[model samples]
Target chain A: MRLNLGLKTLSIFTALLLVAACETAPTETGDSSGGGATTQTSGSGSTTTVVTETKTTTVQPGSQEDLVLNVGDRVFFGFDKYDLSDEAQATLQRQAAWLKANPTVTLLIEGNCDERGTREYNLALGERRATAVKNYLVTLGVSADRLSTISYGKERPVALGHNEAAWAQNRRSVSVVN
Target chain B: MIGSVQKIRTLLAGLVLAIALASVARAELVIDITQGNIEPMPIAVTDFYADNEATAKIGKQMADVIRADLERSGLFVPIDPRAYLQQPKDLQVTPVFANWRKIAAQALSTGLVRALGDGQINVQFRLWDVFAEQYLTGIQFTTPPSNWRLTAHLIADAIYKRLTGEDGYFSTRVVYVSESGPADRRIKRLAIMDQDGENHQFLTSGNELVLTPRYSPTQQVLTYLSYFNNKPRVYLYNLDTGQQEILGEFPGMTFAPRFSPSGNQVVMSMAQDGNSEIYLMDLRTREMKRLTNHPGIDTAPSFSPDGTQITFESDRGGRQQIYIMDADGSNVRRISFGSGNYGTPVWSPRGDLIAFTKLTGGKFSIGVMRTDGSQERILTEGFHNEGPTWAPNGRVLMFFRQIPGKNDGRSDKVSLWSIDLTGYNEREVITPGDGSDPAWSPPYNLNR
Candidate 1:
């Protein structure tokens, strides 16, 4: 019965998650990758298929000392994909475990994107990405009420240079927690 | 032979080095035009060639109107047409680039007025990108001589869009609630005009009290509040169809009507006695959905681009601030938490920044903050500057400022103005008579 309840809840959450595009829904949000993704060239001119947009991140049981999470100070998605890479999940899992231990903690998840898309669209997408991470943590037993999301879109940029490095850094969601 | 062979090798290396340096320059020239010199583009507006007396009268009036429209942009510095190099009539052929460049003009406007045989006038205008040495656009419109002002406005819009790569607000119109006289004898009217400050038409004629006049998302339809027969009601006006319809006849007062981004629904604030909240009504079905139920003043709601979420100004946090709620009015979160009080949160057409009115230090200023409460930057500051509407490109903000207690308190000129996001380009928008509370419309889709 417990297992059935867990599966039922998971499926319910899965449906709600896609509809809300987060662990929770904030009002009308559209996740356009600003524009579509830039086809990444892998040396021989062929393209890589989109295997996973967002990786299912699981918080490993640990203390802060056990997880010196890179949390990527930055993560780059293709155009507008808010999905996590294998590396991104590893970083998120560590951060998730930290939040699991720190129950009294509250966080501000800031959604951000590159300068490639329209401002409003990028902002909504950013919010959606952060909400995705927040929802993943909620499913991992972290309290959903503690996580709040806001989209910076292309406004508050970390790097001002209009280059690949700058765009890579800017197209990321930083987990700002208090 | 040895020396010649060595020279060829050296030349090849030098050529390769040059190409590398050129490519690096292309990458390094990152002019972060986050802000531009908001100084108005210097322009010359000569009298368009007119035919009849009415056309001649309109030609001069429209030239003045275009000048005012561009000057208010704070982006263009209007040059005195008296100092023009060539008459607008001569501009039909070509212009001497050297002379224009000599006058230090980066952009110029040339137009001609023609008398259509059907007792109407046709005006043609073009904006020249002097630096690019090309015409941004050449537009011709035929209207009755009385619409000379609109024709001038159309010319200004064409010039504006061509140069800025955005739709011009000049040919557009502003529907605002005009207030006059003292608080006891205050008269309110739904006033309309060409974006260039001509053709002042009063829809309500100051006989009835109107609160807000918001433009429809797709058409010339205007949705606003009217206190007709002492009952505050939401009303809609189809400018072309000459049709006026009531949105919903709720028992309470309804105000602050704004069309959704798709133009299918109208979101507004309704008050039942002392209780106020936000609601959305489908124009087709007349079905109303209450989005906010807080006893606090939850008003001034604007939808996100996709219409799934909304941003509004509320006093829920014990003070007037900005909040974001879901489309169903769930998961309400506060988006503004800076020191100042914020209201009239307008979502950008591009859906990024929210233009708002901020009252800090007892002064009203127009500003924009990110969707979250961080990085709140004030764009324009004044004693009484409020109500910011974003240009279609999300580059400029239009608002109004009044010189309080100036000219012995008799000359209370609350006029429309615009400024770039960078706070540099500040210009007084041209409007017929004194204007206030300007709202920019989206690009004309089916509305025109």
Candidate 2:
């Protein structure tokens, strides 16, 4: 009877160890998820959360959803164009105001292109688009150091379709609160 | 011990006998296949004979792969096996050339597979000109059971080389981007496959975006662009070692990378502060040089076969066009004066012509022209077609074709397609998912 009780305790210990291992494995491999949140549950029915927050707390005033809700996160462009239209200019004005209101918020402006052009040319055009937005924001008094930019070219198309409508939507610049 | 010894002796005797029979087969007649008709050569591939049950399965599989490879090349038509008059065993002993000619088959291929214990297989095949009653070529390969498909490809290469008087591209592979998922969250991974779309494997996970994978000329190394850490940079990946490292930590984005002919340097475009220009980096000394100092975009550089000149696309002339320059980035001259914007210019391995993607009349097409931009011919046109890569022999070009999705815009498919150098025999290269940016490797034996 005593031996049976000891075996049961050892198996229970092993089960707890496995649970702990699974919980930790995702944190190491899930770097793209950004937040890298780790949840731990105690054996006594209590819960603990260990979140390894990196690069988001200082510059991001609130959650991403909150930023997208309060201010626009994207601006669209015309076909094969990096120059801003009237609509794009107005959107950038609003984005500039948002940046002014949130002083601590840093921005990452991602430039994207439609899938209709060459990959290398699209990258250059995307950079032009992002730079256009950044220049306009600078004129509105946002510090250039607080804003960084990257162009994804046609590699990251928001629209999967080959139609003009999808391509129109894919050519845009998005602002992400770091 | 005696039984094992006897088995070894029997195998040796069989090898010697096969060699003797092959020499006799060669003495029958000689057919010059150099001037065959423009139409595909009609061939019959018999099922390979097997020595055992396990080998029988592999033998049938290998023959199927070989037949598919030949047929997909658009140079040969594989006659249906059901129309074959004799069994595989009978053909292995001796192919009745008159029977194949009677069935309208100009070429006949027969083979045998033997199990050499310990999971080894011996594959022997012969290509015969049925009308001329001559053996074109015969080869034997021994490999592990798992590598039976490669053995079949090697046989197909032998047949192709013997018939065409050109190096066979069958033994090479293509590196491309496999795209999946919805448009907004599309996942692109680096993938490689045999030239015939066999032995497909993904080299990278979709967690990071990768593009434009180009194989090295002398090694199993690939140079490509990856958006890792949100920094778009050039990276080198070794196929044999499964190790990858960023080519350099440039202060800006680097894209459109291609390896030099010697695989000792990489040429790509680096964009910073709204300008993109061509740059070259020597892998050995980590030395970086600016190849082009244009304010406009200069990218998609390809080295000539001799590595003395580079052909690339640039918009410095107010519109996108093809340009050529010396290895040190001097004597820049425009090579494209067509009606459309030209980009993604790839110099053929033969170093005589350049393949490029043209955008005109609101459509995209793949075309080729002389290095001096003469005798321009558009190969294929569609809604979206780009990224033309050449086969190892420089006789064929492969690119991606993107078909429009439905009204909901959900099922868009991008597939790889190949075309002959003369702009004939266009065919789709099948892949498991959407593929783009295909770069063909040099022939497998070139480095050796």
Candidate 3:
């Protein structure tokens, strides 16, 4: 349908502009250990491990390598809950490690929801979710000095189909590394 | 025979005329009140039954807060206290239905209190349907005198939910950072309170600067941004067990974070070495996925109801605008194209529309539009309005507005407010202290 095509074209045009703008913003983000836990200071050890040395570990900043993140990095929440799970903690730890070395970095935590309730409630719900992550990192020995959190309340999304997989993806806390 | 035919013809003409009149009556202008004030279910709140000691001590401050809460819902109107006839207690035996009906009140509410055998005060109240001439709802709640305000708000929420099929947001809680002093020397701490602006409590002292605080979808966990060591990161607090933890240890800055629709994952924005993108982390497995890979500054990503798509803000189009993409970052697109730069696009749970902030011609407004970027309409306009959150019904949005009183800082006053999509009812949603960045919670359907 023309509507679908138009949507695609509009997004591509906007995405191109965003990518170009970000390219000049400066790549100063600390290397992420992974998802949930993003502490640059290891919970167990203080020795810093260079994430870039493992070429296979993280996507090189501005490199030609594919940046499409696999499912291995996304953190999920329980129903109506925003606490970071052990798995979530691990992911954030990885992200934290990456952030420590990259001092000029900033990020936006987007709270999202699956399609089941009202929009306003979801927005508030989304906000609570993003705040949970920001708070968790602040306690993990990461500086509250560098973080900002915002909620989309289920307005923006990444998947299109209407199914369980889509819903699973919809119920997430996304990290936008600047 | 000639006479008989003439008479029959006359009768037929009369019948035709009658039919014409009936149709005309049916076509007459008929307005539908079915759309009744979806704003907070307006109810008249007289003073709550309080100890003569309490009422005399605080004046009517408690009653004022209740009235404010019901009104702030954009749903209820606490009838002017001057309208009280028999008082909130006179309704126990029989509320003068005629008195409330005369005020055009669809529902009536009243409250009172007495010491319970358990030492805690037992507050009692009733909600009446003036039209139906019956008590719609009434109950007794036992709480410490300190919690009387919270109980009063719960009463308002009950009446609101009974009249409207939607859940009430009054009883829920909000946690946010309170900032004061100079920008760099700002003193910040975490504060929590009922969505109605009562029972405000500080979670942490404002010695260090706190940025943002968030709530857990399923539990009492609250996460937030703090600057204890001059570095910004996320921290969590448990309401029930009083436990605390840190989310992650990222290198540069890990700012924004949110729980997935199921409340199982955290989707947040991270900026490393200047590259901004959206990523997701599984709470159970700690797995990670990059949702956006544009060279543009992609931040503020929100999920669609189904989670397969996300909407976010980006500078890819020369200015900040809203965009959506596949969950896996396969198909990316832009959603805002109005005269202003758009930021903070949130999907409705109903999957029909998205709400956003429009910065146009130097003025800021909150508006909504279809997912495909058509049929956009601005709901509220002012000197500045940003950080819009929704009511459970999507019929209303809550945002903060700031207006400086004078050139001096004394004029810089910020207030929380709610407005309907039709733009008919615009009022302030009350918050303790100067309020900003209000996030509405899901209808609190949980049992007491």
Candidate 4:
């Protein structure tokens, strides 16, 4: 029974992740272009020259921007568990490929937790999550020297909901180019 | 206990108007605090007698502060002074027992403030049992004119100890993280204030994230986790000098710091390769010893009162549970067997119980249990409550409760709250902003 429930939750979580990624990707581009147009309109004669720099249009291969936009720089974890899920492993595999392409790029893996755990315990759990991602990248032939990790505990969350959906998003690890 | 005098700065004599032998028996008019529920004793706090207007204002202020201190303890209720038939002048000689009794006051507190030639103040106070019409306890304090608040706290402590037979926690301060901003980008600053939430001062500028500040035995130093320069490590903060330095260099992230009972050592967790283990560091020699070699997380270690045992939370048993080990990391034993996850186990100052945060069925609870994990009792439960810290007296526990915001959880309000050991008298300790991880300081013991 427990295994069935776990599988059901995982499926729902994967569906939610797809919806969230789709919703956020366009919003990010739209906000940047909207901000650019506002800034140009405030100037004397640059309103017509305002250009929307979309993520795909200005993508640089092997760059941090490209890693975030194309390869997916983040991997989510289950509550209180640092072991990577199947989907998380796939994301890390993509991230490892990107890092292997960008041989000169070093990364910082930031581990984060949901608000459900205690602060001190969450700090340790976050480190584990970050280490899990770093280990996967290392297994994929990434150099250990090129990776560093830190846990932000539950102090930072990307979602603002009190439900399971927000918590699933908050409990994640993000590989940032340093 | 009645004859005890706490003299500070100067040993000026504490005047005794009348030493009635029967007062000793009347002092037995005590409140049984071990029980969870009890009515607050009605006591009258009259303004202290002063000869001039300048001293009169200080006298009134001291009385007001004393009244607030006693009332906040949840043991006593300072009766309204307007119904007093006698003025401050009546306390100059003795409180007329008949007048105090008419207002239904079971106890009465009276005092006098005098300015000395050396620009200091001499404050003396007496607690009287109205039903017995006898003096219970009294003390005299000589301090600088600017320290009237501390003097008032001392007087309240004396009265509290006399009536309840337990050491008072009023003369202590609390160190906690003052939180503000939204959830994702919250800015937390190290803040300290009197136990009553007065005399608040922020120790950190909130530039770096700080958490879980624990006071040293001397109360002059603090060990906490800070993301200073973006490195999450344990750092030592000197309270007096406003100086901070990272603890000894470690291989990985060091966090969940707590000082030993003697304040000469610190126990914390250092994470390497994602595995955290408890380690002890001596301040004098900077020697480090790894205590736990578990692959699972073991952190938040707190010392037993005698420094002989350490209680912490670990997940080595496939889930988070409370565990106990000797001071030297020997004799490791798991104590908690309940179904829920247990974390942040803090030993009581009195050495009888360990307070912890328990999460079961998505509800968080602040609870306590015996050192052996027997007689588990939940004190308070809510949507999100964690990090239980004990008061200096061991009679109360302080922790933070996070409530969802009206619109969203991003703007949730996290506030510090305190509750007695009996699971009653839960009161919010109001701060200027959101507060968390409150650690109570040892009694100042100013006169010791």
Best by lDDT: 4
Encode model 3's per-residue lDDT on A50-83: one tens digit a residue: 2223335755552212111211223567654566
Error of 1 at B243 (Å): 5.1
Cα shift from native, residue A89, model 2 (Å): 4.3
For B401-440, candidate 3 gives per-residue lDDT tens digits of 7654432223346667777666657787565556666655
lDDT of 4 by residue, B1-448 (tens): 0112237543223445446543455446798899988999999998989878888999999999989999988999998888898998877666789999899999998888998899778887878889888887777776777888888888888888888999998888999999987665578999999999999999999988999999998658999999887789999999878999999887689999999999999999999999999999999999989999889999999999899999999999998999999999999999999989999999999999999999999999999999989999999999988899888889999999999863243457899999999999899999999999999998875634
Residue-level error in angstroms, candidate 3, position A119:
22
Task: Give the Cα error of residue B136 in candidate 3, in Å.
Answer: 2.6
Better by lDDT, candidate 2 or 1? 2
Write one digit per residue (lDDT tens) for candidate 1, span B1-448.
0001001123122433344345432222112325567334566666776666766677778788888777776556778776777766566655665667767777767666777678756676655556555544465665566666656665676667655666666655566656565321346577776554455677776655565577877867888766565445789987776677888777655766788988999998765533458899988899999998775667788888778889988776866789999988999999888886778888887777888888777677888877776678888887678777776667778887776442222344667887878877677866655566577766544123
Instruction: Give the top-scoring candidate (DockQ).
Output: 4
Per-residue accuracy of model 4 over A1-178 as CA lDDT, tens digit each: 2353344233323222332444333232222221212222223223212222335377677765567666777888888888888888888988888888889999989899988899989999999999999999999999999999999999877565676756777788877776
lDDT of 3 at B31: 17
Q: Which stretches of candidate 1 lie over 4 Å from their true place?
A: A1-178, B1-40, B44-64, B87-90, B116-136, B142-146, B241-244, B402-416, B425-436, B442-447
Candidate 2 lDDT by residue in tens digits, B231-301? 88999999988898998878888888998998899998888887888888999997889989978788889
Candidate 3 Cα RMSD after full superposition onto the native fold (Å): 19.9
Query: Which segments of model 3 are wrong by more than 4 Å?
Result: A1-178, B1-43, B46-65, B87-90, B102-104, B110-114, B120-124, B140-146, B207-209, B239-244, B305-308, B326-330, B349-351, B402-415, B428-435
RMSD of each: 25.4, 12.0, 19.9, 7.3
Cα error of candidate 3 at position B247, Å: 2.0
**Sliding window of 10 residues with minimal summed lDDT for model 2 chain B:** B1-10
Q: Is candidate 1 or candidate 3 better by DockQ?
A: 3
Ranking of all candidate structures by their lDDT, best first: 4, 2, 1, 3
Best-matching candidate per TM-score: 4
TM-score: model 4 vs. ground truth: 0.91
